[model samples]
Target: MTLQFSGWLPGGPTRPTTARRCELAGGEGAVVRYDERADSLDFAPDTGPHPHGLAVVTARDGHWCLTNLHAEDTYFVENMESGGEFVKVAPRRRDIPIPFELARLILPVPRGAGMVKVFGPEPHYLAPSALSGSAANWPRLDEDCMYFRVLVALCEPQLRGCPPGAVPTVAEVIERLGDGRPAYRISRAAVNHHIDYLAMHKLRVGEWAGAADGKRSYWKREAVVAMALRSGLVGEQHLRMLPSRRVTARQGPGPSRLPAPPPRSRR
Candidate 1:
């Protein structure tokens, strides 16, 4: 599992221009300080010492905790996956559990406000028997199908620890699903068809979100991604299906493993 943090350093008058990122494995801890003498990630000025400092964060298998080391400011961890849900870590609080699978750590800084993008690990699944018989009536998706490949491609950016706003376009989805296979080809129409099939037939997003065809392509992509990620339909494990060249070409590191999906079972 991985825990990544992104912070902004002072750069200009209006907004912080420089960004500093740090990564830690499970069981690792680091101090987010802002001074010339500070260690780990230092969001100090381009020159001398700055009083802006004091925050500690630790990582675990699936979640992380933040300690507000500053004596005055209370830190806020906003759950980016959810709609504006946030939790506050009181001043001097230690190891407050953060429940967001994807989050933003907000800090009051010399600039108007400093933000850190926090990426948590994929969620853990409950025991198979816990809800074994209850899923019979639910909409079913086959991971080995071509349509499923399109869904995974659409959600790749977020699944690979990028922001949720990075939903791929239809052309992008076609490129991702191409993967250089023999005689494998997908067109824009084919991709849109797959997405439409997913939104209306498989997931039944129309009941509340209305028809997918009426909305713009951007809205349809976002709706599909939101529903898929929220329901744990596509995740980090499925990212292997994406081509490695394109996968690592993304901002952060891709998953360490890229094994092909198990051979599709004969129906």
Candidate 2:
């Protein structure tokens, strides 16, 4: 068997977001899935000779480690470009790092999505689809805050796990960020423009509204939020930045350090 990719790999660096293969740890690697049921990464064996060795890392922990099933280990051929949590997979051969041939054979699943599928000798774990990865897609900051805000609205509430909140409409976004009572508010029309921006800049934006039967159409919202969370755009900490939690911090009075000044001169 060989790798089968969705063919969503990027060629080189893309603006606002860089796309160097070697930039992030073995960033040149392909995206793979994490099988929660097997507790192992899913890898489909290929016809070509395997590479020198496999390098693995995990999001469960930020640590990187190596394990070799054979002494032929020389290079680390694993791909990490997808930025998902990495898991160690034993290499069939130990000569080169992950072989380039595997690139075509490996299908990219969403990084850290915890997808599960049971099939091969090893149960097939579900992975996020290639569309789940959008390292090359960058939103225009100044012009697309609305879009970014949309992602924040759709994604931030239940970043890692589902939290209490509704799928906010564009009106809520416009009012929340717009500071509706203030002069610098955003208009509903502008919010529409930004939603359009999500199609290209955000991962899984379009999928939310058109999901299959019974699944929450809002799954796309979760998908994009998870993507944003993984990619570092809007994190758990950023949730406080939301308008609902708009409390200003106050500094308490401190101890006196200097002597009290003489009564003010009647100058």
Candidate 3:
């Protein structure tokens, strides 16, 4: 892939609220579906690659759920991108990481699919500590807050798929930071110090947005992606590239416009 580092300006919201991809027929093609009501997309396989294969369906909720063979793994959908007949397919992984303040995952849609939904609501979450005090009481403020926010953000909408909250939750953070360690005892003051250190050096929070209309407004993740591109924080080629038609143009090769080479001294 050609990795370009051009920055993108923050643009107003675009259509298709949620994008999704599903592995079809054993990873051949994916069916991408966006739902305005759910503010998300549903991906399924279009063909059966094997008599039995695994299909992954990812939603806007930031979770990937698996579909079994006996289940309805394949589906038919019309292409919004192309005014063609409906096709059967599954979603494919473009594996693009769209950077926000942090990296947000971006899934690719099939070539023919277009905006399926518009103007969907943003994802919501309840504070993690609202459920339990165990991890909530952890002393390290920054780590605790970041971990709490990420876990809560991932789990809140999928409560039915998850278990009841636990104080010291068995979340990914615990495993990543090493579970059952006394590091959580690090004091709030120390956590603040680390945050300040990061701010002074590496981590930056830019382009603040004010809340209006009784709605909590924050910078769109795309803004951060644009900033990263502009600053060369991440390569532009990493952004999901949609298929496009080639522009027709006529041009001819031209000789270099340069000063004539210096005459060689003859012996």
| lDDT of every model, 2 decimals | 0.69, 0.40, 0.30
Better TM-score candidate (1, 2)? 1
Off by over 4 Å in 3: 1-178, 206-267
* Tens digit per residue, CA lDDT, model 2, 48-129: 3335213321111122222233343222222222222223335433212222212222222233212221111112345756
Task: Judge candidate 3 at residue 210 and give its lDDT.
Answer: 31
Per-residue lDDT of model 1, residues 109-180, tens digit only: 554455677777666889877866644655678998988899989888776655557888887787667766
Clashing pairs in 1: none
Residue lDDT tens for model 3, 198-259? 32233332323132222522222222222332343333232222112245588888898999
Q: CA shift at 34, candidate 2, in angstroms?
A: 30
- Clash count for candidate 3 is 17
* Runs with alpha carbons beyond 4 Å of true place in candidate 1: 1-97, 100-108, 111-133, 136-138, 180-182, 210-215, 246-267
lDDT of 1 at 187: 83
For model 1, state the Cα shift of residue 168 in Å. Answer: 0.8
Clashes of each: 0, 16, 17
Q: Indicate which candidate wins on lDDT.
A: 1
TM-score against native, each model: 0.54, 0.32, 0.19
Indicate which candidate wins on TM-score.
1
Query: How does model 2 score by TM-score?
Result: 0.32
